[model samples]
Target: MDLEKPQADRQRDPEVREPEGCLVVAIRLPVRIIALVVVLPVRMLWDALVVVGRIVRDTVLRPFGRALAWLGKALFVWPLVALWRWVLVPVGRALGWLVKWLVVVPAVWLYRHVLTPAGHATAWVARGIRAALTWIYERLLTPVGHGFRWLTRYLVVVPVVWVYRWVLAPAGRAVAWTVYWTGRVLFVLPVLAVWRWILVPTGRVLAVVGREVWTALGHAWRVTGHLSLAVGRFLGTLFRWVFVEPVRWVYRTVLTPVGHAVRDAVLRPVTEAGRAVGRATRRALTSVRESVRQARYDVRRMLFGEPRERVAMARREPAGGETRTLEKRVRREVSPPTRG
Candidate 1:
């Protein structure tokens, strides 16, 4: 019953085999033969080379690289680190301390003890001198200046004021009146008459003429705009009918059908033929390359003799208990959250 169950399963399997017909066998036999005769040996050699490379890397190259890295660090990095840590750092700190003591400390002391006190003393002296000058100006010079100003006002300013008030003022008024009447008769009246009569009427006439000219210019500009718009519309309509419509009709009605015919008849067949030739050329090239490789292999075999066959490495995938199947999806579903 167990055996029958397996047979039933095999019968139900989609991958169960069918016997090949002669044409299929004919085609497949050459490919399988080529795979076994050519590809199998090459695949085995490649696997062997991969294993040998891994072995060499693990046994020799990796350790050698690590050693080289360590040697490089010891030669280049460690020396620089030692120089910076032991020599350069100590020297730099010493130089910094020496500069602080020799230059910075002395400068600070000079500014604080000597320069600061000297500046304060000079400021005090300036303040004293300023106070003394202020006292002299207020007590002695101010009263003397006031008395002098009083004497000058009575002696010089009082007489000058009297002369201007009593004598000079009336004479100046009389002279000003005479000058005013003389200028009024000589220059001002005629100028005023000319401005009121001549300039006003002439300006009014020019203003009226300018207003009419501006109105005419505006009307002419509007008429010109309308005519330009009408001519542009006519020319656009003419161009569409004469050039654009015919060209559009030719492109859509004539060129479209011709293009379709050329593509269907000439271009398509030419492209298909080119693809077929390319496929054939690739197949021929593959056959030639295989033949050349086989010939070279045969020459090497004749020269060096046959090497011992290597055992294939074991696969890591499960072969027991139907661990995985092609029909099953690999994705897993996550659990939902608990209410707590």
Candidate 2:
């Protein structure tokens, strides 16, 4: 009965076999699809983000790392550096001496000996300055001083004045007159001849031109007189029509009660309306100024606080839930109610 029961159970269970390899593969297919579609891409992106973040962090921290390395090297590796420096000191000195011999020493000698006092342009400039100063003193100062001294001696001193009046003064005047006469005789004859020859013809032409100009001017004066008379008559008629009649009409008509009515109704209301608009605009500007002051105070408070992150969060997060709650709290804290 046990054997029969086992056989019956096996028959009932249909041999009790496991699934085939194809079934296992089919079952894993969706999982593989999910991995390829969702998991693999997410993992790859996560890894890429991690790598990018690492690169960014390294880029940002590289300078600090280099600074720390340099400091460490400076602090701990100084003895090796000192040894190298000591070993190179003689070489450095030799190099420096070579450079001095090659470039600096010759340059200094050339400057000192050839480019200083006896340089070509320098010596020439110095000589020119000295000559100019000497010439100025001799030509300008000495002559001025001698003339003033001679004037003082002749004008103020009694013996010098007597010698000048009797001897030097007359001789100077006679010599000056002779030289002046000689210059006059040399220059005046030719000048007078040229003046008479050229100027006589020029004067004749000028006289003819003057007479023509006078005749034209007389005709122009007659035309101008006639034009002025016509202009005066026209202006008289225009003045009678424009100024006098308009004044008379205004005095007669516009000073009446209807004019007063028009003035009171139209002009006065327009003036009052203009004044009211001006006052309203001024009040609006005053309110805007007060609002700006409050805004500036709020801006100052926000700036002194952590504004960048808050502003970024506010821009990113919509005004709902936690954001609205926070905004309400911030508004309440930043702007209290008026105590009216």
Candidate 3:
């Protein structure tokens, strides 16, 4: 009885819920009616606005835009294009051809015929004048100049030179010889004679006396030289023992150490400083060189842009079958048609 009651309640549950569902429906029916009544007129108005906009665009705007375009093309663009292509281009070409044929041709022909011949004629006249001048120089002026030269040379120069060589030279030589001989005879011979006779004997006696005195002096000098040599040897030995050896010893012991100390203290440091300065200068110069190289590279990049290697790739040719097909097409295109 309980199982039957539960099954019966499940079957009757939907029947019992129908009135609540109908009440909810009854509640939503007026709202749906009010929404439909409001939205239908709004939709109709939107559709009417859309239809009007489409009609305005299709009927007025599209045709007007197309008409404006056509009018612009006809009025401005087409006329200018036609003027350039048909009128201006053809006129310019015709003017160019006319200038070439009329102006340039006539100018060239006139130059070739008249101006060149006139220039040649003028050159021929100039050459004739030059020939006339050359003939005058050769026949008249040159011979006259030569005659004058020969006359001057033979008449004036030869006579003067001959007179100087023969007459003047001989007279001058004779006068010189006479003066020389006169001086020799008057003064030199007597002096020579006096020297030979009196002065020579006197000088000979004086020379003998002087020779004896010289011999004595020479012997005395030899003795003095030997005594002075011995004294000099003693003085030299005394000087060496007293001064030179001590000075040498002092130099070896005291001056040498002092000099070495001074050198180490002053000169070595100075030398090392000089070497360091030189190394620093070399490094600076190397850095400057690198900077300059970089600047040069930058300048080159700025001027010519980066270096690019261009490789030329060979074009791939058509295969044999393709080539044959293309050739057949070309042959068919090029060949004349036959009558069927």
Ranking by TM-score: 1, 3, 2
Clashes of 1: 0
The digit string of per-residue lDDT tens for model 1 on 1-340 reads 0111267787888888555345443444344344344444444455557768999999999999999999999999999999999999999999999999999999999999999999999999999999999999999999999999999999999999999999999999999999999999999999999999999988876665564455444444444445555655787799999999999999999999999999999999999999999999999999999999999999999999998899988966756785765544333234455698
In model 1, where do residues sit more than 4 Å from their true spots? Answer: 1-139, 301-340
**What TM-score fits each model?**
0.51, 0.19, 0.26
Two-way TM-score contest, 1 vs 3, winner: 1
Better of 2 and 3 by TM-score: 3
Write the residue-wise lDDT of candidate 2 on 1-340 in tens digits. 0112265676788667444345333444343333344444344455557767899779877877899999989987886688668867878999999999999999999989888856888789999999999999999999999999999887789787788889998899999999999988999887998889998878866665564455444444444445555655787799999999998888778777678898999999999999999999999999999999989989998879645554444465555565556777688899968998
lDDT string for model 3 (51-88, tens) is: 68999999999999999999999999999999999999
Instruction: Tell me the deviation in Å of residue 111 in model 1.
Output: 9.7
Instruction: Please report how far candidate 2 places residue 156 from its true position, in Å.
Output: 9.1
Using TM-score as the measure, the top candidate is 1
